[model samples]
Target chain A: MTQKDKSILMIGCFDTKEENFNFLRQCIVSHGESVIAMNTGIFGSTSLFPVELESDLVAAEAGESIGDLRKRADRGHAVEIMGKGAGKLVSRLLTERKIKAVIGMGGGGGTYISLAAMEPLPIGFPKLCISTLASKDVTRQVGMKDILLMPSVVDVAGLNRISRLIMRNAAAALTGMAKVNLKTDEKSLGTIAISMFGNTTACVNECTKLLEAKGYEVMAFHANGLGGNAMETLIREDCFVGILDITTTELA
Target chain B: MTQKDKSILMIGCFDTKEENFNFLRQCIVSHGESVIAMNTGIFGSTSLFPVELESDLVAAEAGESIGDLRKRADRGHAVEIMGKGAGKLVSRLLTERKIKAVIGMGGGGGTYISLAAMEPLPIGFPKLCISTLASKDVTRQVGMKDILLMPSVVDVAGLNRISRLIMRNAAAALTGMAKVNLKTDEKSLGTIAISMFGNTTACVNECTKLLEAKGYEVMAFHANGLGGNAMETLIREDCFVGILDITTTELA
Candidate 1:
């Protein structure tokens, strides 16, 4: 494989579900890309590339049991903190440049944990998640980044026919996206960012039209919680010239 | 006080709590504001403001049953739709430009519904909510808009000491925000928007430095879910020239 074959980083709880992990690994390798799988579950087998950072380690790493963590009654907060730690570890790995894409599979908790890990990546970096709750309102989970959610028709407990099909499609999607070289031209016309909601459609529409008429390119994001975050992410990347925040509905 | 001074738009469930309704009405009038309160609950109030746009009226207008609309499983989704209907009615009042600000009091469902109504107003509009759940995580309720949240310290069951204090502060905040004559200046410098999260702090910092050094003004919004949405609102208003969204963390 040439240097053009991108390295895809797959992060998830790979320990208990060996079939899914192996299937995803085989798929990534088959596509002629490098795979660096990070296992975040406390009970999972030793990760292929084990997270060495002390902060990335879960409470179980300090010999505390899951039951002990639960007894604190702030289990969700504890999990979130740990997810942030793991995210830092993932961020360090992403800075290395070899990891071009990221994909994860999980239920609700795992989805949260994986997203926390992927949140540090820049816009246009491929990110995907296959989860049972993908069909539901994942506005909170998927926020604003370019993370694609693939609904796992079957629970990711074991690799069955349904799981295999969903995982395969997700893998294919990531592989395709990873292979495609996104053209990032600095010389293009500057971009303008805009936010809109269903209620303020008229105002934003008029504003966007007026701006575009003036030779500015307008990128309107739904001012849902995540849409807002996505626009902000692009702003940090120097992607837009000015913002027209018409519908602050979500914020209100 | 003149009738113009008493023009206030009051929103809440006035069905079960007649005393609360009377209390809010008295509060509105005492502060030299006219009350145009809309009753969202099932029961009618003989003493307080009449239901200008009844829920059944809204249902008839939309060609849907009030019962069917109320049957939505997610209370949040239900409130969102109701808020839309309320927003339409309020917009008409706002057309007269008499509604200097909006003040609301409620629980989780009420706050959600009220925000939906208040969200369509442009930024700098005076919006206040006195909510029992205000002290909790209100990111979802307030989103990116600048809605002031005053914790009802006491449950909004009746007008008690704590309730009085909370409501007074809310009223005062809205009145002050609305009454202030804010000077507006046309933004001359090109605006740049950026999203930041703790994990991607380095990227945003470097990018912001780069943009500001190039003679652009930078507006950095935390890429938490709502911060992203707020930035989008500004974008739709034609506020920013470019966006550098490095900390696209919340999108995951």
Candidate 2:
């Protein structure tokens, strides 16, 4: 038996942006990659292309039915349930190691659902969102995840000149990320983190040299706002065995 | 009695980054603007300059004593309390109409506190944050606010070649925003919201012309993810009389 090919998980509301998704699917296919299209649209599914995961199945994952959601006629509630459903489904696919990357495009609700779906995925996983809200304050949707947001300069309404160019670029980026092989050195001393600012650079550099000389690998993070946040997240992920918090100014 | 001059709000942990804040204050002063510095630092206050609102005062706003916080020695808990305290204090200052703009610079904790302080400010108000985490995911901190984040490429430690340049630019930007008077045209017949995409541009253009001919002001928002989200926000702020959701693709 042969191993199944890892697929790019494409998520969106197929009911509305069917034309745009179809073009995106073609772009992915042109790169010789398989796509697992998932429809999160509550109203209806698309007939333009085949969807591996349908809206009904996605809603079912959230313990709801499409009919019930439609009957409720609440867009906000529907968005929440659909987002939860897609998240669970994507999580399962990740656990099965069936997906190499995830890509989604949409306006407000689509962006929300896509972010929610990608939220559970591990760090460094290829997660891309082609969204209109890319340039906006997406602090709530992104929430510390390394989710790459591509601004849809125009709306993701149809495959016009602008949409075509952006969607193609987005497809290429995602495909490249999915195909790249990251090399890691297995033999290393336990990883140590050292925080540094311009003021503490000299001290951090000296520490790094001494640590390396003793066969201990040292990773330095800038004591900037983002650097401190990143280091904290990595620490929570157990990426470092020891931490030398040299510049703790971020604790202000 | 004369009315008090509107001052730009400067927020940071003065105990540590006192030098940086002092430089920024001087920069603002050079622009002929007054600054209201608020210290969120829990350890101690700065002797470099007068801070109108001190760390102790900020902590007290959160119903905690600076001495008790120091005794706890809990960094995360302190960040939360200090952020809340600064937020309340800033909110009161805003309500009192004492500030023209708000600006802050920091790494992690500073970024959090600064953002929390500016979160309650009105939309369209000038809010600037020079942060190390500017390039990182700050969704939780920024939320839906229009906070302009400037990247402190280097750690915001002391005055260095990099820090000086970036900090100076940030100061200039904030001062410029603070001094600028935005003009509003008050002679509009009621504002109407219209959603549009590339595919529906022609239709929307025609509709907009017809609406304008009927003496109604038409505002078209691209039906992309961000556009939809922004439109929803504006709608909630009562900026529109009616909405023509032509392209609802974001609901995907």
Query: Which window of ten consecutive residues has the lowest lDDT sum in model 1 chain A?
Result: A180-189
Q: Write the per-residue lDDT of candidate 2 for residues A113-185, one digit (tens) a residue.
A: 9988986765546667888666566666766555656656456776543456556656765665565412111
The DockQ of each candidate is 0.01, 0.03
Candidate chain B TM-scores, in order: 0.75, 0.82
Per-candidate TM-scores read 0.43, 0.51
CAPRI quality of model 1: incorrect
Q: For this target, which candidate reaches the highest lDDT against the unseen true structure?
A: 2
* Candidate 2 overall lDDT versus native: 0.76
Instruction: Residues B1-252, candidate 1: write the lDDT tens digits.
Output: 222453667777666655665776775566566667776553344455565556655443334556776665555555655676777767766665557667777877777777777766554455667665553455555555545455453346655433443354345444444434131112222577778878877887788778768877676666756557767776775666787877777879
TM-score of chain B of 1: 0.75
